[model samples]
Target: MTSTDSTRSRWIRLLILAVVAVALAHALDGVAWRSARLLSVNDKDWGRLLRSMGYLPTWGVIALGFWLQQRDHPQRSRYAWALLLGPALSGGVAEVLKLLIRRLRPNPDVFEYAFRPFADGPLSNRGMGMPSSHTLVAFAGAAVLAQLYPRARWLWYTLAAGCAATRVLAMGHFLSDTVVAAVLGVAVSTLYWLRWVEPLPAP
Candidate 1:
């Protein structure tokens, strides 16, 4: 197939997968949430600790540490480009979507369908749950770290999945929220990597 055809095919597959994921999440959101809650009934503290790993600031700190360690290495520039910018762009896009959708969190009183599209004031804790920012950052960083450290890709993905799970376990977001974020995080970060980070001249 031609390059154009190959790209089109890839996009088509992504669209199909996204549709399927949304449908599945819609069908099993409550079931998945309850399962997570049950599994973490006695370990919510662990869930909270894992959840912090997904925070955007935590990602920034990680990238900073990586940069510090690799600064003298030859791939320093490339690592910096991918590690720093990938998660930032992923989290930024997720934030925009959150503000646009304004979906509610899975907190005690709120239901999943609660939304306030384009509301004026700042988003309260109860809202802005769609395409979770934490999951986005976690997965985005994982994608970059996996590429940079190919041998430990599984480790990176496992941590990212753990971070995503914490959201549901802690009732911070629905399963659908983390599911969508993981998809978007990997997609956006991969695209960013290809478009910008991948083209840097090797040192």
Candidate 2:
């Protein structure tokens, strides 16, 4: 099978695994809470930087970076737009989940929370708290870079993970929330790149 096909299948399997992970984490929410408390830190500079990660202006910067790089490497222009789309694709899924799941999120002021899957109604902000949107976006961006820059794959993962970790610190997002979202984000983005962004195999 082609690389795209292989990657697509891999993400599908990852999705299944994500579900299992989410379930397990949800079952052990107390542990997730404890981990969050332990991992959290108080650093305004780091918190502010991480908060900007999922913001619109940040994505514009990301797009501009792509534009600059693509100018010199026109060959990459074909699929490079995928970088900008990366967060969008994964973010869209996260939003839908937020509306459906309506998971209760921990207050930024309060450093405690739990996973409330299927505990929320459509459009409810409560369930949206389970799979962190910030973490998902981070992973989505990382997934694209990981594919494009194979050599710097570890760096991309680090950035993605670090960004996700910030959510636990900034907002009382449980490790479970960030962890599950991180996995799902990468899985979704991998599938998107394979299905839409990547060029099809030459016939």
User: Against the true structure, whose lDDT is highest?
Assistant: 1
TM-score of 1: 0.82
Candidate 1: tens digits of C-alpha lDDT, residues 1-203: 99999999999999899889878987898787656564462266766666765777776777788778778885666677677678888888888888777887876544457776455555543467898888998889889887777789999888888888877777878989988998888888888877877766543
Model 1 residue 16 CA deviation (Å) reads 2.2
Model 1: residues >4 Å from true position, as ranges? 38-49, 73-75, 107-112, 117-126, 201-203
Local accuracy of candidate 2 as per-residue lDDT tens digits, 100-174: 666677754454543454534445564347678888888888887788777898997887777777776555476
Q: Tell me the TM-score of each prediction against the true structure.
A: 0.82, 0.74
Model 1 Cα shift for residue 18 (angstroms): 2.9
Q: Which candidate comes out best when scored by TM-score?
A: 1
CA lDDT of each prediction against the hidden true structure = 0.78, 0.70
Q: Where is model 2 poorest over a 10-residue stretch in terms of lDDT?
A: 113-122
